[model samples]
Target: MILLDAGTTYAKILNTETNEKTVKKVAELEKTFKADIGTGHNINRFAKQSVNEIIALSYAGKRLIKEKSFTLLDVGSRDAKYVIFENGNFIHSDWNTECGAFTGQAIEILGSYLNLNYNAIEPQKEFITATCGLLGMGHVFDMVASSVEPGIAAARLIKGVCMSMYRFARKPHKIYLTGGLVNNALFVKSMPVETICLDRFTLLEGVLEYAASKKDDINL
Candidate 1:
């Protein structure tokens, strides 16, 4: 079986039989290459079976996280979402599309434009009032124009972005974090709350898990 978590910019693919995983640009995936089970924005276009990203995350959270009560947040290319669980049971979930506009994309483009290495940027105390990625990026540009070092400006933007995500997740004491940002050290460090970064493949794992469970009832 194959599973895919295809986001706006990239696709995380998993071969269940081999337990091998690969990340590829969404544009590079052939139209004919479909997954047995899949989730994410672009998955519907190529997946034989589709699952809601949030539902996939819930399955992953229950399988991966050991905490009885916790918050799991998946900040993807286009948006941010979080699920709250109490005593191992999901209680609430929220997906922030409006204010989270182009968050991951913003970071990627800004880093490329600035030639900034997120792993090297230290989390800073001073951050712009991002409110959202677009507004935050505006602040970054203004700051850079004012002679703020490009790296510093970028760091501030990342911190602001992290803060926005934190606030949206209701500022949990500790977050179970996943998605593209998990690999960005600065983004992880900038998170105002304690954060546990999960593998970027977390969502793919969820898709695989769901496919396994439904194999007996559904043809795949």
Candidate 2:
């Protein structure tokens, strides 16, 4: 199946059969690749069959975890989401909109600022405390000015962001961590509660499930 996540910043395409994933800029995708199944900011514009992101994640998360009740914390580009799954049923969900503090994009920007790759981050302590992404960046700059090592500054900034996200979530029994940040070793290491780090394709998996459920109704 061809699944596309037309996210605000970067767009991703997943080919399930080949188990291959590709990432490209939204602008680049706009001029190319018609989506068979799509979810994200401009789904209505790009998708032949558009699916709601939350509904998709709900179905997708269930498909992965099966009849076990769990919570899903998805930290995406512009927003972060908290989804509750009660034995594979979609029960409750909430998201962050008023601030960028809960976003994984913040981590991306942090990596650029400190020149420390997220994937390369080793286990470290939570030092930075700024909740907002931009604010955390400001703090990073201040630390650099104070002659603190860039690596340490970046790790602390990431910790602050991850911990802030944890504070936003209502802790449940089981937790699955989804989004770009899951690829980061240190952030995953610092999570207070043990979480299953899912691939970035979590939402795409949901879209595919949504499409299958609607196969008879939708033309696509």
TM-score of each: 0.95, 0.88
lDDT score, candidate 1, position 169: 83
| Candidate of highest TM-score | 1
Model 1: how far residue 97 lies from native, Å: 2.1
Cα lDDT, all candidates:
0.87, 0.76
Predicted candidate 2 versus true structure: per-residue lDDT over 46-157, tens digit per residue? 6677787778778778777764688888877777777787765668898777466444676777677567866666655756777577787788889888998777787787
Candidate 1's clash total is: 0
User: Can you give the lDDT of residue 33 in candidate 2?
Assistant: 65
In the order shown, the candidates' Cα RMSDs to the true structure are: 1.3, 2.2
Q: What TM-score should be assigned to candidate 1? A: 0.95
Q: Candidate 2 overall Cα lDDT vs. reference?
A: 0.76
